[model samples]
Target: MIAETRIALKNAGKYKPEDISTYIDLGGYKNAEKALKSKPEDIINWIDEAKLRGRGGAGFSTGQKKRFTNEAICDKCLQKYVICNADEGEPGTFKDRIIMEMDPHLLIEGMLIAAYAIGATKAYIYIRGEYTQSISKLHIALKQAKEKGFLGKNIFNTGFFLDIEIKLGAGSYLCGEELTLLESLEGKRGYPRIKPPFPAEKGLFGMPTLINNVETFAHIPYIIEHGVEHYRSIGTENTPGTKIFTISGDVKKAGYYETSLGVTLRELIYDLAGGIKQDKKFKAAILGGAAGTFVDHTVLDTPMGYDLLKERGAVLGSGAIMVLADDRSIFEMTYSILDFFKHESCGKCVPCRVGTTQLLLLMNQAKHTKSDRIELLNKLLAEAEYMDQTSLCPLGQSPILPLKSIKQYFESQF
Candidate 1:
């Protein structure tokens, strides 16, 4: 029997989301007090040992990202920044939205700890403009945090000051990308920036910046409260802690469910989510959001871990589990996903700008044309691979995921 873990979602559904007193009653911001007292290096080392990877699809080491900004040699620039990528624009991923709306204080507390760790005086929560409720909740939380001395100058008399503000994004999918988020925050068009200098080195007006998504920031307080061993004991060795999966489509109960990293797909679909909707046979599930790969029932028992999914050419992108019933057509699903990517692609680089459109065209052809469908699919696969290699940001590289999955698992559908 697979069980649900609620470390990140601990306060979710348990209290009045907008009320800071409810959050305080539940021991919120306790970690921030503890984190403020400890040395930043100690906190970084503890996170590194815990192996808490980023929850915003990439699964990169969170501790390493913090260390980079904390250790960045930017003597010339005294200003540093921390950004919470609360865009949550990924198609089937709404976990971040839940965290923001339900447990706003958790996110604020996490950001406070993160800003202190990197000595960042200013922080911004770059949320999507469409998430008006979430924005309102965060605004209330931030104000309450500041009023309680959790934010602002000389917090807790530690002389480590931080100020957090909210920046609304204009609902661009590309803005979910860190560089593009920075660009949008800077009042420029949301364009993916070049990589030789990552956000850690030079970000947010040429100052060292630490940016993580809402879910990633939500995990900081838990790690700070319980030692690394406590977190490691819940999930696999390499991928520790619980993850909030936003389950949708063809499921009896399709919402956010928090579980350990190693939970199998079968358990998620059957025990936790109350089986497929109307007891239909499970066909496939997209492991992550739109940029994630599809998996069949043959791998239902496979453990959901970062390294394990990578071996299968899939990603735990944003922890989105979009299930497909036997009645669903793989071709239609592929077409819709491709269409979204094509529509959302920012026309900055040739690979993403043109490649996504080309992939969408081929998908259209595959869906409508009966003649030479296999040839079109073959060409589509090649185009997706080319885009993966040449694209500027992750948005362009996403085509390869569904394209490869369809070719490998559902080629007969074509």
Candidate 2:
């Protein structure tokens, strides 16, 4: 059975918008109810106690970000913003989409908890342009939340005022980055920024802002209501809470499945995904997403989490695993993944912009001429290795992870 997410995503898809009173009846706003009664420091303490880490691709700790943003808010700024990043643009990661569609209310409750802890009265959930259904669902839920006592002035009669707005994107994958996301929110073209002035310090139009993934927000309500100890029992010591996996390709049951962290990749594909169809032999798996690590059968038993994947030379990422079996051409996979990075580079940096285009050209040439294949492999893998670590942003870097790992594991197939 799938283990339920208690802290962040408890009320998603289970309740309607007009049912805020019913949600309150069913213990929906209990966390906020309690937070309103307790000190702001206590709310921060609770999240730290829960060990609630960010489920966005970055996996930064929410408690840590909150602690930083709360501290960074200037004495002059009157408007602090808590932002929910709903732009789920990773190629194979659709788990965030599922939670946004199913449980927007839980997200709102989480927002309330965040606003209370950080002294923010305004929040926005920026969704992708492609997610028409999820955007509509968020709009409906936000409107209902305003009508109920859960949102607006004096929430639950506590004199705390919070309002949430929904914003739509033009569908750029780079906007998934926190800085680029803030840029887009301000009606500018999305371009990632340099660190040392990370979003926690100066974000969302030069004000203190906190941006978290949809899955990260969905987890908040459960953590606040159930407390941290119960939530910590589900996953690893450092990586607590159930994770939503979006597994695709060469699998029978390709969809969203929420399971505890540290669950084996074998269990995900073989048990949860029902294994390969028509008895096809297993070849490899793409742990994370298109821009993530490649795991051959040799590493299939590795547990899923943050530190574990890092040990296996991967980052676990947003938990979007793509299974690949025999008969698929490694050359084709390499070309396709490179092509995607080439198109999505945003041209903000030369290494990624020029490098991806060159890789694509070399891939095209390699496809036709067998002699150029080895040369292309060396050039692409070597350059990609350099780019992954040295690029201006994670986008430029991760585009080559799949290509390099594929070349390393399945050299014969290419």
Candidate 3:
């Protein structure tokens, strides 16, 4: 009976998601008003002190990103932009969709605070087109906010102006990556851009842009509304705040649960999610989504934080935990995962394109080959490592995560 520690989801399901009045009645836009009066740099400092990290798999510091975007020098006439990544394309990860559908106003308020902090007057939410309910809910919520003066031009008579728009993604998994999403946002093909000029430097039509995922932005209001000390008190010292985990597959109570950062897999699977389905033996769990690690029961007690999981050579990517019962086949799951990477590769880079295809081919060949399973695993690991080094974007580099983890934990399945 482990209870959820809700923060971003605090207002979810408590009122009409599309109604601005219900959100306001619950003291929703008060933080935005409070933030409007405070110095933007102070807000950024609070975030930095709070140690809020991006919830979008990368786990980068949110405050550092804001400070970079705020201090970044452009032509002065060039306007800064704030972009929210809502492309929820990760397999088995639906937390963003839940936030968008259940508490769209919270997201809107968070974006408003972010726009003010970074001096951005215009913002966009690039959501996956497949999220029809979320899109509709966000549209309604945006309209309501605008009507209530929470968005668009001067708010609380403070003279700060901001407007937000929604952009639909065309079902490209690579577009979920920030750089690729930037290219797509600029009406270009979805492809990862080279680094050094990160989004905080040149982004969204070649201006200083601040990009954060839906969950990352949704946490802003809470961090601001509650003091930094309060926020830092919830999760582990390094990784503050709760995370919305989307658990599915072989779990009796498979759904999204928001818990503090240090919650263990054992607590998540057994206490929160009610353990494996039908009292079946737990075989393994995918700690992240498709491009995540596979772990056996041995690491159940390990805490589910970014640094903690990374210490175990696992990633708490997108907070997507997919449980597997003993009846599931690891080889079949690995093949399917490889196949997904192969199909999703944007083919813009050689390593990822060729690497994904070759990896899938190797898996297909493994089905018929009488060769030593260890040798096959070694071969897959070698190829994936090469891709990790040379591939341009995360898509090109992601196959190695699952492949390497599977090789480490489930070699017998080969």
Candidate 4:
């Protein structure tokens, strides 16, 4: 009987998705108005004090990112940019789309606060193209926001100006990565840029850019509206605030549920999601999305937080919990996941481009060649390890997570 602690999703299912006034009546933009009057440095300090981690998988410090972008040195006249990563490409992860379609204005207000905090007048919502409903709802929400002075010049007469535009992603999973997403935003092929010059220093159009995902941005207003103490009162000491967990697969009531960060997987699966479908025995759960690790029933009561999961060699990536029944085939699921990585590889670097294909081929060979299954599994692990060490981006490095975790928990199947 673990209850949901809804913060970002507070307005969901409670108002008209396309109506701006309803969102306003719910006291949506009041925080943004209050934020506009405050000094940008003070706002950044407030976010720092709140200890809001990025909700879009990375769990980085939101305040640190803003501070970096704000303090970054460029041509004094160069404009900074705020971009929202709404690609939502991770398999079984639909929480961002829900935020966009259900409460688009919340995202807008969050972006507004971010842009103001970082001294940016322009913002973009780079959303997945296939999300037709999300795109349409955001379009209407942007228009409504512009009409209401929530956007554009001199918002709340504070001499601050901000405008947000929507950019459609052409269905590339690689673009969900922040650096790769930046390349796509610039109309280049979706390939990841090298590090050391991270996005905070040199991002979109070679300016200081503040890039945060939809869920991360959506949490800003809440943190601002409720003081840092109130915000910290929820969730764990290190990972404060609620997380939106999207549960799918064999669960009886599979969908998105928002709760505090420390909720156990057992609570999420057996209690909230109604357990495995048809009373079947539980086998394993993919705690994150496709790129996430697989876990057996032993870790069910482990709290779902970034640090807690990381300590167990797992990630709370994308907060996507995909359950599996004992009757399901782990090998088949592993193969399908490998095949997906193979298709999504951008071919930017040799490791991912060839490694993904080789992994898939090796899996196919192992499936048919029963005697060498262990040998092939070893080879797969080695190849994934190589790719993890050498790949240019996360897509190439990600196969190791699922491959290793699956092998660890279900080697007998292979």
Per-prediction RMSD in angstroms?
1.1, 2.0, 1.0, 1.0
> Number of backbone collisions per candidate, in order?
0, 11, 0, 0
In order, the Cα lDDT scores of the candidates are 0.89, 0.80, 0.91, 0.91
Model 4, range 188-264, lDDT digits (tens) per residue? 98989998698889999888899998998888998888889999999998999999999999999999999999999
Q: Tell me how far the alpha carbon of residue 218 in candidate 1 is from the true structure, in angstroms, after superposition.
A: 1.1
Per-candidate TM-scores read 0.98, 0.94, 0.98, 0.98
Q: What's the lDDT for residue 258 in model 4?
A: 96
Question: What does the lDDT come to for candidate 2?
Answer: 0.80
Candidate 3 lDDT: 0.91
Error of 3 at 387 (Å): 0.5
The runs of at least 3 residues in candidate 2 whose Cα sits more than 4 Å from the true structure, single-residue gaps closed, are 1-13, 17-22, 372-374
* CA-RMSD of model 2: 2.0
- Span of ten consecutive residues with least summed lDDT in model 3: 69-78
At residue 205, candidate 3 shows an lDDT of: 86
Candidate 2's displacement at residue 77, Å, is 2.3
TM-score of 1: 0.98
